[model samples]
Target: MLSSNIFSGPIATDAPPASIGSRKDHPVPRLGIAAAAPIQTNKFYANFFLGNQTAPTYLHPYSVFWAGAKDTSGSWGMAISHIDANQRVYGSETNPVTGTPRYYINPVGISSICISAKELGSTTAVTSDALTAFSARIILRASLQGASVIEFPLVQGSAFVTAVFNGACPLIQTGIFYKTVTRSTKEARPGITKYKLYLEDGTTWLLYAHHTKGDPLDLQIINNGLAQAKGPFYGVIQVAKDPGNADSMYDRTCGVYATDVELSGSAHGEKGTYTFNFKKAGMNLTTTLAMFALPHHQTSFDDQTRDKMTDVKLQTTTKGIAIAVVADSWTMVEPSLPVSIGFVPWLPEAGSISNISSTNKTFIHNIAQQEMKQDILAQTDQPSMYFAGKALAKFAVLIMAIHDILGDNNLAQAGLERLKQAFARFAENKQQYPLVYESAWGGVVSTASYANGNASSDFGNTYYNDHHFHYGYFIYCAAVIGHLDPSWIAANKAYVNMFVRDIANPSPQDKFFPVSRSFDWYHGHSWAHGLIETGDGKDQESSSEDSMHAYAIKMWGNVSGDKKMEARGNLMLAIQARSFPMYYLYTKTNNVQPPNFIGNKVAGILFENKIDHLTYFGPQPEEIEGIHMLPLLPHTPYIRARDFVEEEWNTYFANGRAENIVGGWRGIVYANRATFDPKGAYAFFSTPGFDPSWLDGGASLTWYLCYSAGM
Candidate 1:
């Protein structure tokens, strides 16, 4: 096949290889490791060549050269399966003698490079599978030049035989993987331009693909001034398994293409190549085929967004984790969990005491805590990983609320356990991590390599990290899931501790990785803004229980029965009241209104910046911390239901939002389903609402506020 020389040297020669950087006869693939020239526009992103978890935006480990930039330049993923998983054609690999000990050869999935193609005149992409394959069929997407027509040559390496061109193709595509369904030409045009397809199976068979006619040329194939064909055009096609092999040339024996179809606009160009590392698809615990399909976009939202709550929650959880067998699409997610969507529906108040029962008047209110937990407010700009966390969080939140809403504690408890199982997939040692770009689910991602590289956005528990928000929010879930069969909480104490510690001192490091200076896409904004590493944020000096840390201390207090935890919560609450921007105005200009509070989101302040008038908006006057926190803050939905009696909550039904006390913010985008300039305080009506396809562009956050002091 290949001139037996490609396998030039002994692969595993360096037994107990000298440590890296050693100078004595060092040889470990002598690989080139140059830093790819950085694109100056966005400095924060370094995924183009860096092998960190945050830069998972590019499919460098799995995609092929022909796939184009799913996120970056020169990042094609390739893999080597343990076995012939999805059998493809034409390739080669060396096999050791029968009794010799075999090396771990195919563990990476792909065996070798592939080289095969036909002339420009060919129609079908089919290549003949003449020789035994040592590799698989490589996929190529033709999206360059914005032209509908494309011509790819069937090649072995530098050389080309024929071309595979789609002349006068009407339908232009955005991504590769376009399906060919049309049986014949929609029209006909000039000089060998009108092409059709046929096939044969062999190496280097004669190809037959036609070019569209330049003008209305005389052709018998035209019917009433139009051209159409009922059957597949005739042609010779060829195939191969690996490109290195000498016999890898394509032929028509396999019906790849018939003879005599001319190619007009065919040209050969070079696209960089890459080597992939793969494994048995099942080895990674990707349970369903649905995981491999293209990704379904999460519903986008803006600051304080108020819609698509359910869909966002569902996509977050269901996407790469669960395999839905029974029903397809959101319309079918059954036994709908109790959801408290935006705005309690207006059913005219049927006068107070004269009614039979308070429950009758406050039907939605009876399940207020339960409904609130289920009322997810997912935004469109969130990372899919964020959605993954949402999925788990949604399930946990709903289950915890079940007992309160339906008075079925057992069902709620059962739901938590199921949720735990789902969340476990994203956890690294029982602690959540960001989701994979192409989660082993239906939604495929192409933005893994943007300046906004944020693979860890959804699962991290650092204060600013969205997953941190989820971690604190999910504490109630942990209790329920472990109530019945308790083992996880105690077993993963380290994880719990790390989570708590990170929450207390969520600093620039926790918010980002490497350093803040590496990229600008990342900046501290208190939400999934991007992977901003500022070397700032709130860094802690000690892990010991202290008043400075409220969230962490509260968590540990609940779990460890530590008194200092409560004190810390108290102190943290006090600090937050002054700095949180919920009630204070920034004075950025004379404006920045509705909610006058100027928070990191409203003020565009990085954590590293000092809180002086010159840096931050300055602390507000007369701010009360924990004094007003309790009446408004609902306890974990589960605990509230179980601990608080009916009498305790009945008063809440009469007046929920009388205080006008504003606190937590989801984001402005969350309030309205449109984009807003982050620099501005309010959303602009001048621009059209974001087209759903551009969810990432106009993503917004929704803010939440406690409504009353009476509770």
Candidate 2:
């Protein structure tokens, strides 16, 4: 069961400010300036408290923003702001005169901008806390305050209320740094800028230029409590040499910053010495890591009892300049079908909290408890999710949500622990992959399987990339869950700067990827999902399936923290409305002839969607003689809540639909593990917000409530 460590919403805790500064509107800022802001750092341990062998990382957070400037060059600019940071410059395009959003300031010359975030621990030395990874969030805002050379924005963690600099300088440093663009898109203008600053913590930082082309070299280290990340601190700094130029170092890529530097070990007993290297390597930024092993002895998983011990392999680039880690392998995820959590043996005790809470449960406590337990048990034999075995991948989201939703430390920690296990299982046998594989767990799981059991993309591309979109979904889900579980991803803390930057200026309203047809856009329409028929021996055909736009939008929102999901979700609803033709049908199943759908006309829709709906050909076979969830749209609405709730929330937090899924947020499918059923009488709604709110919506709700009540 999830440990009950729901983070619930935002907290009221706050930290003191370190220092504040100001900026002016002179339209230009300088280099070597410094700023300080209140940084809160929090650390917690799960492995020790859980009494489990695996040691996990706790989430740490604090906030910082940059303060820089822009020149009248209409090109020279420096992007800076430490807190409430934004990824795009002048990304906020609001016509103030019209009260309509226009654009953010553009192209600030940034020679060097500083960014930082800290988590303030409530008390010294947390109890029974083990950190698996460490991560942070910084919100940078544009402002002009004062002098004292302070160049970043700081937030009073006490209320999440942002604070501008104390004095006014010509520049705003903390948030986003926009570089000058050599060219602009058909609809947007370009930018150019530069700003640099140093830190009192003895770290040197890099700044962006008006015309940005390269990225800074950095490494993020992940460690469990079993070891502390230690490093000998080996590095080489290279730069462009100029005999006549005395400020040569000022214009070129010279290495300057390193944090948590250790000669041989890290906090929490980690000794994997990750080497830091920064310089011009060929035409791109390059980073190299050299880790030293932990002294822990080997043993089978403390609980899993499997003979295969953990194998964490690290691979180097072809040129041997960069190192890539092939995380531990997941035991067997996809056997012949998706892995159902209800039947995953170890889990079901924890149904999704959101689902259970959303359902109109019985008024009585014991009955409600029993109903919840049975809800999970009832669906034991069902497939893990709709398609693409992404269930396990999305499940990682619950961990992040735990610490935020319920504030149940035990349950939240449990979720995080399980998430680590799932990730390890997902990142398996890297050496076994083909030369060009990129998705994290490509080789470990079968990329594809035919009725004859073959790995051929052509025979069935559905299964081929089934265990896909790991990093993509992980980051996205983390963003949403993080809003609640603020400390999500403390362990295996990756850089979220990419996501943080996109919040203010997300994909513009008009930008879009042209899909071949309704289905072929992302993975073809079938990728959304397929309609399942019960009591039928026939396997599901991908063509009957379609990609759930809601699912995609949900993931994108969670990852980006931008509000673009609503529009995307609404767009999918429109497409689906036409796809299913929503008109009611009173059909005599036995005589419902399946359409060969020759020539254009209705067949055009099928061809456009790339669905082989014609596979059944001719009259629809009268097999079940019962009503099942079929598509008039994208996804099949859940007729059962068992899919949403599991024991604690392994299923719920990872879920996508509210009526058909948990929070109507996460996707309806899982990845890397579909090698994996249900009951009761009653009705349930399919699409609540979009579908007919009166009849179809009401009936679907009625059925779902009955199922939840265990009627």
Candidate 3:
């Protein structure tokens, strides 16, 4: 059970803009979901219900896509693909002779095995009717009025794909062009049928059919390579990758399947414990259940729980290999959750920093006054929500530093008034591109795409891309304003809570939004890609910004006096610290990625099937590494490890290499350097004739100087 205080207050009350309505130009079709409530726009299983519904949905060890649709190879079932390390293809090397390679990518939608029913063919219809946080139900039925209907439950972490047949016969097909299909009867179990499928490449797969309420199935291979069972059957069919001990492994988790996962957590002082309780549908309670645990999960498992782990380790596309663990529940504890730091530079030694030299204080106050004179409207009224929100957050930080660190009440009060006016532009729905409650998919989205008739407008906000990155900055700004003046919270709490619910709603009790929309608890991170179908699954480019989003939630909870919300944010930040080092931030000791690809230091664009060292905007080295370090905040030092930062500096920006960089990237590089060398970073920012162009649109000299000095 979740803590009673996890979510209760303004977030529980759903409020949309008064004049908002559904956009007419969006292309998403409401498939089996009839709630008329808000549907999840960015989740792991979204590819199964979007577009032609043939794109791959990766659930770790196994990935499945609809194959009968026109978008795929035109087969009549669900195609499954699993890739090992040997199956990966490498990109071009940086140096022809001695340099390391740029990337390594796994193959997608190979269809090593296809699970189909005899009644499914060209005239069959496939629809994703039911969806949840961890599983989705894909329905397959023939076009005939009286045809049998089959349902396949695709669950995360389950090694097998289970299909429940209703008056239909099983037909096991393959796009891999199988070389042999052999029926095995070595260990006979009641109500169970077994077969081994061998592909041309010497790969073997195990198929087990469990009899539920009908006669046993007699499957045989005919002239074609596919195996087929006789007609008019009712039972469950399961398919799995045969590592070894096929009989023993199948018997342990024979007739059971995971339907969904229930998540709950609680934080006490500096520690937090979170759990994943699987909801299973079949089999007895004493039966052993098998689920795959990632590297991060395995590292945190207790000694007693780890003793039950098997030696079967399977390769995942992006987040290293997953180990098979036999358990129904998994519990992990984050020992060092960030529970103290507030709206100031964070010091692990003393929580928050206050001491500063008189000279530096005078300089910072002077810079703040100069920057505060500029027009706030011109900075925050842009068409793009990402940039405009960032601008608002930038000024909010400057105002806080002036009031908290420098003790200038009048100057801070003046700037706070202008900041509130700028914030009202979006809260009142009066920006150039106002937001609307997209009734079709059921969350707040920008009207820029619908107005211009382009899906890519505003960085695909209308289609559900980077919602957290766009709205997190505003949440932080609201927290600062509400902290300075508690009276302001009553006027704007609903509007601010709407943005929080759009991205990080913690409970499903609020019917207008899904729970924890952006963060994936299983993956220990949040994904940015949404709605669009791609050869690779979801990808997140900015790990630093991801941490910033979590930091904003923590601060907002503190200001709003929501203890559980604050605790949840602290747990999320701690999880990011543990998971980022294993996958995204590569150290020399890492054994997860390929040996030759570790020299790059950073996983630039991490996709499900590939890890490419580049960004969607450009191929510059500074841009690739700088995306993970922008808008430096109080949580920056806690998330970005010191040793990793030292290695990154030596590898890319050492020996005055950072001095040669131009534009806002120079400031970003200097701010990141402060994690290791505070004095050097302070010198760079406090230079007599500092160029304002060197600062990013979302960064200020006052915040950077104070951060460096405090460190």
Candidate achieving the largest TM-score: 3
Worst 10 residues of 1 by lDDT: 263-272
Per-residue lDDT tens digits of candidate 2, residues 531-625? Answer: 11111111223221222223333344434443233233222322332223211111112111121111111111121112122123221211110
Candidates ranked by lDDT: 3, 1, 2
Q: Tell me the lDDT of model 3 at 640.
A: 85
Per-prediction count of colliding residue pairs? 133, 190, 0
Q: Pairing residues by index, what is the TM-score of model 2? A: 0.26
Query: lDDT of all the models against the reference?
Result: 0.23, 0.21, 0.79
Which segments of model 2 are wrong by more than 4 Å?
1-413, 427-453, 457-486, 489-549, 582-711
Top lDDT hit: 3
> For every model shown, what is its TM-score relative to the native structure?
0.28, 0.26, 0.95
lDDT of 1: 0.23
| TM-score, candidate number 3 | 0.95
lDDT of 1 at 543: 11
Question: Model 3 over residues 606-640: C-alpha lDDT tens digits?
Answer: 88778888788976767888998877988888888
